[model samples]
Target: MNTIDEQLWDYIDGNLDAAQASIIKEKIDTDAEVKNQYEELLRFNLTFDKIELEEPSMSFTRNVMESVAIVPAPVAMKTQVDKKIIYSIGGFFIISLLALFGYVLYNSNLTMPGFDQKINFNFNLDKYITPTTVYSFLFADLVIGLIFLDRFLRDKIVQSKKI
Candidate 1:
């Protein structure tokens, strides 16, 4: 709205100090436009004062709370996982690892020397243990460690939230 309406509103609400109120009062008395606006605002204020606000029924809050209570509480996404599914996945991985280890051992060739014969241990591990192999193994270990740490932290957070 214009400054005139704002000043008139302030004057009607008695928000303006004596000096500002007197200036607005003088304008309302002398200017026909100002006088008309002031009378309209005064009628609106009186109408607003006469209005009776309707209140809600006494059981409104109780009814709303009862409906809310009938609805189920939300469950965490992680908590929705079934224990049987996790156990099955873990069992599958364990069995696969055991089978792989057995296959490796069964295919390998190694001879055990008799007690009467001298045992010769002349195997060089340098060929199998290259720098790249070592770095890859370390990187794999770091990635696995981070995965485990992440799982541990997530579980901790879920547990804390439950409390």
Candidate 2:
């Protein structure tokens, strides 16, 4: 019942559909409360329309704008690089690698220093596995985790600034 005024206000603002609006209009014409609300809204709207917005002083604008000093737009964390330059560098490296690989393949003749027969790779895990190696792997993972955390925090800070 109390919210009927809000609905009437919406109707006055033309936010209601044509059919609903017409119905509300009929209510405003026939119902005392609705008509009273409509009149009040009209008066308030007219008053609001007549009111003038205060303009900021020229010095205020000048001071604020001057304080805001011109800065270059924010760039991506991963700087934009020319794709052509990257591709050319990659192409050069790849071509060099391919040439070297081809040369090696063509010139290669396998010979062991002391082996009488061909060496077969029967890779035994027990021969290479050690406690220090496990600790080293754990340490490496921790450093990687720290780096990931730093990057994540930095990104979050940048995102917060954007918002």
Candidate 3:
């Protein structure tokens, strides 16, 4: 808006001090353009005053509040997990691994040859260790590593969120 329109608005809204109001009033009375603009602004102000603002229905706020209330609150990942269940699963895996190791050790030949005699270290591993077995072991290790990494990352994220 131009300075004249601003001044006229201030004049119409009675926002200007006596000196500014008097100056704008004189301009509006003397200048034809200022007078026309002032009349238009005055008509707009009157029309705005006469307008009745639309209001929401009485149930609008209640309906919105009810909908909001119906939604379940978010749960934290840590809280959703039970410590006892985690401990039991870890314990079961550890026990099974130890039992398997014990069985392997018990069945293996561990007799040591005399120190004076020549010890033959040659043993055929082709029967037990194939290419497929090596690949499967490596893949299992990779998967286990990835699972550990995922857990570590999730813990870090949860810790950061707390902060």
How does model 3 fare in lDDT?
A: 0.94
Q: What is the TM-score of each candidate against the true structure?
A: 0.43, 0.37, 0.42
Error of 3 at 37 (Å): 0.2
Q: How close is candidate 2 to the true structure, as a TM-score?
A: 0.37
Worst 10 residues of 1 by lDDT: 109-118
Off by over 4 Å in 3: 70-163
lDDT of 2 by residue, 1-163 (tens): 4678778778878899989888988998899987888898899988998999999886998788777767566776997799999999999999999999999988998665877687888999777778988899999999999999999999999999989
* Colliding residue pairs in candidate 3: none
Off by over 4 Å in 1: 70-163
TM-score ranking, best first? 1, 3, 2
lDDT agreement with native, every candidate: 0.94, 0.88, 0.94
Report clash pairs, candidate 2: none
Root-mean-square deviation (CA) per prediction: 14.5, 22.9, 19.5
What is the RMSD of candidate 1?
14.5
